[model samples]
Target: MTDTDLDQSYSAVCEALAQVGEARAPMLLAMLCLSLMSRFERADQVLPLIANALAQSDEGDADGR
Candidate 1:
């Protein structure tokens, strides 16, 4: 996906989470991750992306969460 496509997708996800509200937002996001990951043929390809995401996480927050 291009940068524009990514931005649009991010906006859509934010809107969706907003609509789902805080209580069920985590479930919604988790379901989205699973749904997207289901399309990958190998976990090996996806694991690194997860790691990269974690690596880019909030450094200021001492607790990993």
Candidate 2:
């Protein structure tokens, strides 16, 4: 990837790390996986979309009584 692409990716990683409050490595890894999966469907381009889906699922599980 070019420097701009690398910078964008790094910025995304930092953003995810700050939002999720986790180690940067795992968040970065998750981004990579999501980006790859995004190839099949467009959802991978952004992390928040995946995170929202997961959060919604968590809420559903909590309310599934």
Candidate 3:
């Protein structure tokens, strides 16, 4: 997809997550992650990528990246 499409898609996801609210967002996010992971041929390989992304997000919050 093009950059615009990606940007829009990410924005849409954020909006949807907001609608789910803080209390239920994490559960919904986990369900979405599992649904996406199930689509891959090597789902196991995706775990590390998810972990890395999460680590980066945590670091971003910690260091104000």
TM-scores of the candidates in the order shown: 0.82, 0.37, 0.74
Residues 1-65, candidate 3, lDDT per residue (tens digit)?
A: 89999999899889989999999999988998898788888957898988999899999999977
- The candidate that wins on TM-score is 1
Candidate 1, superposed: residue stretches over 4 Å from native:
58-60, 63-65
Instruction: For candidate 2, write residues 1-65 as lDDT tens digits.
Output: 99999999889877777776765668667777766776765445556767987899999999993
TM-score winner between 2 and 3, please give it: 3
Give residue 35's error in model 3 in angstroms.
1.2
State the lDDT at 29 in candidate 3.
83
lDDT of 1: 0.91
Query: Of the candidates shown, which would achieve the greatest lDDT relative to the real structure?
Result: 1
Candidate 1, 3-65: lDDT as tens digits: 999999999999999999999999999999999999999999899989887776755355665
Q: lDDT (0-100) at residue 57 of candidate 3?
A: 97
Give the residue spans of candidate 2 off by over 4 A: 23-65
Evaluate candidate 1 by giving its C-alpha RMSD to the native, one decimal: 2.6
Pairwise TM-score winner, candidates 1 and 3 = 1
Clashes of each: 0, 0, 0
